[model samples]
Target: MITVDTVCALIAKKLGSKATDLTLGADTAFDSVGLSSLQIADIVYTIEDDAEVELDPSQAANVKTVGDLVELVETTRAAGAAA
Candidate 1:
């Protein structure tokens, strides 16, 4: 299972910020890190690289926060395995 802590750590590494800036809770917004749209795309790419999973653009579009992203990744991974 992909834990929120692991997701936060990855986001921290990708954004070059401390994990302390992030929260595992649903209220934590990705934009709260002060990353731009381009940065967010790069973050998605980085997640794909590290997690070894390709994210659908549609699903990626739905991610607005760390928790939203974690859920997307988990669901997409499960669907990928089921296919």
Candidate 2:
């Protein structure tokens, strides 16, 4: 039940920016917006908890945007449900 808007809001809150400041596009780079490793980890964990989906830590490290995080969680949830 996690929506893209919710994810974007989470990202904005985590980054300490207004949601309007982010484009929430697939190509937006996290580092470009000042997201550090610790912040990214915190956001990822929050998403994991909110979505109730476990993500691979290795793969999570490679996520670069709001869309990437959404895709990762959706895909991981799909794969888990399939299994």
Candidate 3:
């Protein structure tokens, strides 16, 4: 299941050492944590692979933090299941 911790871990993995102080703050900026386009792409790819579902980039465009990302994944998964 996609939990907040799971999302944090994924983001942290992508951030590498830059995530040392990662607190999973609800309003934490992705850019502030050094999540570049490549990292975002990697995170998206990893999530898609693990969940076996295609995530629409538009849905994730406004995501700004670990919490937001987790919510996005959960909502996307739920929507996919309904479809």
Candidate 4:
């Protein structure tokens, strides 16, 4: 059920007023939106906490776009459910 919008909303929620000027979409690159590495890490941590699952750090490092994060979240959630 994890979708791009879900991830985008999470980012918006995390960033608060800082995200107001950014347009978020599936293809939106984190860097394009002016997200720093620390911001990205914070977002990833938020996702992990919200999902109650620990994502592979290596896999998280490869995420570049909103779609990529959504895919990672979905994959992690599915894997957790299967287990």
Per-model TM against the reference: 0.74, 0.80, 0.78, 0.82
Candidate 4 lDDT over 3-79, as tens digits, reads 78878997788678989988899998888876779988998898788777788999999999999988898899899
Give the CA lDDT, 0 to 100, for residue 74 in model 2. 92
Residue pairs clashing in model 4 are none
Best by lDDT: 4
Q: How many clashing pairs per prediction, in order?
A: 0, 0, 0, 0
If the candidates were sorted by their TM-score against the true structure, best first, what order would they fall in?
4, 2, 3, 1
In candidate 2, stretches whose alpha carbon ends up further than 4 angstroms from where it belongs are 17-22
lDDT per residue as tens, model 3, 20-73:
876866566677777787887787678777877777888777777767777787
How far residue 32's Cα lies from its native spot in candidate 1, in Å, is: 2.2
Residue-level lDDT of model 2, residues 1-83, one tens digit each, is 56667766666787664555667655667777677788878878988998899999898988877778888999999999999
Task: Estimate the TM-score for candidate 4.
Answer: 0.82
Clashing pairs in 1: none
Candidate 1 lDDT over residue span 14-60, tens digit each: 66745565554555687777667887888778777767788899989
Once fitted onto the true fold, the runs of candidate 4 whose alpha carbons sit more than 4 angstroms away are 13-18
lDDT for each candidate structure: 0.75, 0.78, 0.75, 0.86
**How far in Å is the alpha carbon of 20 misplaced in model 3?**
2.2
TM-score of 3: 0.78
Which stretches of model 1 miss by more than 4 angstroms? 14-26
What ranking of all candidate models by lDDT puts the best one first?
Answer: 4, 2, 3, 1
